[model samples]
Target: MIDETDESLNKSSLVFGNFAVLVVFVLLVGGVYLWVSKKNKTGQQVFPAGVNYLSPKGDEAKKPVLLYDFAKLAESSDWVTYKGKIYPFSFQYPKVLTPLTFPNDRSDAVTFKVNELSPEQSLLFTVETISSRDKNLVGKPEEFAKNYWKFFSGLKALNKITKITNEKGMTGYQATYVVKGKNAITSDNYFFVVEGDDEILLHIGDIFPTEGKAVLNRLVNSLEYKK
Candidate 1:
């Protein structure tokens, strides 16, 4: 009877030991699973090696400047009325020609004029009406870009463009091109243009390097037109 009792107690103990082992195994497996899930949730793994980290809050990185009011510029007398249309009065020295108008079939059209100070030195300004569609006009920006390089390609070219920026710190380009002739005389031409919805302004002035580019930039920046 004592042997039988001992056997029964040993069996019970073995069963209890097995149950305890199983509970420990289950607890270890659950802990491992929870740790792996937590790591994935925090984006701690390297998805692509050597890739740079990006800021999650990128929208708050940049602040934009406020544009100047267009209406306030229109009221100034610096604007002169020509052919029933008002244009900003430019400096008188460079000498602007009679503006030539080109009528597009649509409500938007283009007007162009060339200001020639000398045989090899000239400035061209074109004012065009713009619409939503016109914003993406083919070669618009490229054509404007060529003005800077065109002077460099001409024969006996002695010109360089300087201090080019647009009005509103937005849509505009400017440059000063200097030209030298065979007689060793030198001339400077300055060009500026501002674009708007109903009208555009073009300024071409003779460059006086000693006078610096600030004068021309101020004039271009100060330009205002009627809506």
Candidate 2:
């Protein structure tokens, strides 16, 4: 028969063990939270199972190649300037594309879509405020873009996300992809820059046919943002 003192000691030991386990669990959870928070602040993308990411290229020649006569396009195509009503940003686009409506508040999304919707003819351009600071977005814009690709609903990337910058000094992100049941490939480019407490998203989407893509790339190269 065990003594009453032994029973009390055993009970105390069991309780102490349970308490220690709880403390360890809490510490582990907190460490994970801090790690994720740091990753988000630095901009990291989470990849899904079975999804592949291509290694970045060392030279411009090794990246996904898109050939077009930029000099000819720049020399011949008429261009127009577009200023946002909500965000203090502006950019230029060729006259071949039409500008659509956007909001006039703290954030907006301006789109330029081709009038025709052919598989190869379909093209789109968009500029908007990210509103992440306002909406309390958990991660950086790159992370958001990666999440977009991971669960893109209908599209998957054809190449790795690339880093790009415009002549106006605005840095941007670019990703190219091909959707199922579509004859044309698409490129989604996202430009983000911070102002005050908000970040801007200049998303450019283009479908195949090298001419239109070239025109859009020209427009991207001309993007600008106000201080």
For residues 80-182, what per-residue lDDT tens digits would candidate 1 score against the true structure? 3232134443321111223333344232221222221221222222333322224433335424333433323222332344455545443444332322222
lDDT of 2 by residue, 1-227 (tens): 87999999999999999999999999999999999999876634432211121222344112333334445656665778888676566778766556666445344445544323332223244444445423444336665555445344345555457777778787757765544344433445454544343455656554323344566667777777785
For this target, which candidate reaches the highest TM-score against the unseen true structure? Answer: 2
Task: Itemize residue pairs with steric clashes in candidate 2.
Answer: none
* CA-RMSD of model 2: 13.4
Using Cα atoms with residue i matched to residue i, what is each candidate's TM-score against the true structure?
Answer: 0.29, 0.52
Reference-based lDDT, residue 1, model 1: 39
List clashing residue pairs in candidate 1. Answer: 158-178, 159-178, 160-178, 188-207
Off by over 4 Å in 2: 1-73, 102-107, 113-115, 118-123, 127-139, 156-158, 178-185, 195-199
